[model samples]
Target: MTKQEKIDSFDPNGPASGNRIFGLPFSQKDAEIVILPVPWEVTVSYDAGTALGPEAILEASKQVDLYDPFVKDAWKMGIYMAKLDPKVIEKNRKYRDKAVAYLSAVEVGHEDETTDELLAKINKSCKKMVNWVQERTTELMNEGKRVILLGGDHSTPLGYLEALAKEHEFGILQIDAHADLRNAYEGFTYSHASIMFNALKIDNVKKLVQVGIRDYCEEEVEVIEASEGRVKTYFDRDLKHQQYAGATWKQQVDDIISQLPQKVYVSFDIDGLDPKLCPHTGTPVAGGFESEEVMYLFERLSESGKTIIGMDLNEVAPGPHDEWDANVGARLLYRMANLFGKNAGVVG
Candidate 1:
């Protein structure tokens, strides 16, 4: 069968018939883009639904239109899905239960006899999860595959970032509502809020360009300001001011692009979108960018000659009824494909 026909037969939202070709596949050697589903949401502070995020996104991805209008023929890039780690899921469940029990006890002004033990257990689980993800991501990078992590929460990408750092000295283009610059949050060393702090310590990360930062602790703000030029924040309020001052978003986007290094790693938190799109995300803030605005920002970055080395889309939690979060995530995945297609040197 022709290649286009194979791709056309596979609807991203529809059930995949055995013969239909879904997303991009790697070449004869192996898949070009390796998708690592890290089904972990243990350290999420405010919400509990992100553990199912990866599967929900994959299920919804089945319905995405494969023909990317931007770069064209992005499906040919050979996207390969890795096996979901059920062991990770099991560990995550245990951690979450422990955390919930501990938090519940604390909230009610009661002390559980096993409080200390449970907290210790949860921290251990988070460390193990990070090591596992780091191991998997490192293996894939050694194999010359660009990794796109399907996350359980924003914390899930820390290991991937660590792995990517080993090979590429790149800047982090962080798109998120929160600063994620806390040293450790809620007594968990690997909490979602600490990802950037961990990433900042990694030697290979050259710069951090954080966008959509509307929520952060005062200390976190001080850290960003004190970092000199190493950590640049285009705070959401500043973005609004730019628009209010008659700066077109296109120009602002270009300005955003200028702060980035030639090579970038996009850490996209779904909560960076307007909360309306992802109500279930762990800590949806009061204000953020529209999905299209974020997409355009990245698209402009791609067009301005920056290479997206690796990326992670995280914090997308599915609600009980609507699939809005996954839908947004799947489309973002397509946009990632378009960016990767442009950068990976794929021909249309």
Candidate 2:
């Protein structure tokens, strides 16, 4: 069927169909935006299950309403998420066990030859994951499709950033609870805790602006201080204090947006929101922005004339008995897809 015919036949408010993201009837070639699902989570420091985030979000996305007040007829933009690669999933499972053992040894201050070998293997596997993401994203970008990366963890974006660096120079606007600037949290070079550290190594990433950060270590603070304005952090405590002192969210959001460059890449970790919204996320923090609060920031970002070159949402792990995390992730994905489509001029 023609694209128009498919749209005409689609029931936006009806029950969601199975398989496709948002239950949309559009192939990769027909979609304006393509999402890469990275199902590797070998380095999560705390809980697991984020490797299943892409699949869970896909299932929950079927319930999201297509109408958006912010972007009219947003579903027409054609957002298609790539299927999860089974090879990557298998690698994640394999390295995750090794990572667990490595972490246990480190916690006990036991550094043996076996630990060294395990660490080496885990790092090698992670680098392979990065390479895989870069190759796929490069293909999608070359196809003239805007991309959204659905990740197993924050570390998943390093490869995506690498691919973007080859094409455009952009700054990252990171929304997360942790600083993610540790050199190597658990002796793993590509550990999730070291994502921002690895990201800074990219020449095309000019600046890093972080918000909703309430949990971090002294080393991360030192990294931020040492960045010499290259990194700007808006601590959650400070933002709350500002609000308590009569400063509106709009005022704070404007300040945050001012620190970003003209070209922006949004890195959203589910833990950036209040724990109530993502209790089962890989790492749950105490304080965070409301969903709409972050959404408003995105809207202001678009209105500020900054180009959102690319984006990724990570660290959403669903509960065994509940679908809350995936539900939120799916809705957030939908909103971001629409925002990206509108920014790219693919949606009216």
Per candidate, the number of residue pairs that clash is 12, 0
Candidate 2 achieves a global lDDT of: 0.93
Residue 261, model 2: lDDT of 90
lDDT of each: 0.81, 0.93
Name the runs in model 2 displaced over 4 angstroms: none
TM-score of each: 0.91, 0.98
Which digits, one per residue and each the tens of the lDDT, describe model 2 over residues 1-348? 878888999999898896899989988998999999999889999999899999999999998989999999989979899988999999999999999999999899998998999999999999999999999999999999999999899999999899999978889999999999999787889989999999999988999999999999999999999999999999999999988999999999999999999899999999999999999999898989899999999988977989999999999999999999999999999999999989888896
Model 1 accuracy (lDDT, Cα): 0.81
Which regions of candidate 1 deviate over 4 angstroms?
1-30, 108-114
In model 2, the worst 10-residue window by lDDT is 10-19
Candidate 1 structure quality by residue, lDDT tens digits, 147-247: 88888888888788788777789999999999999987876788889999889988899999999899999989888988888999999999999889998
- Residue-level lDDT for 339 in candidate 1: 81
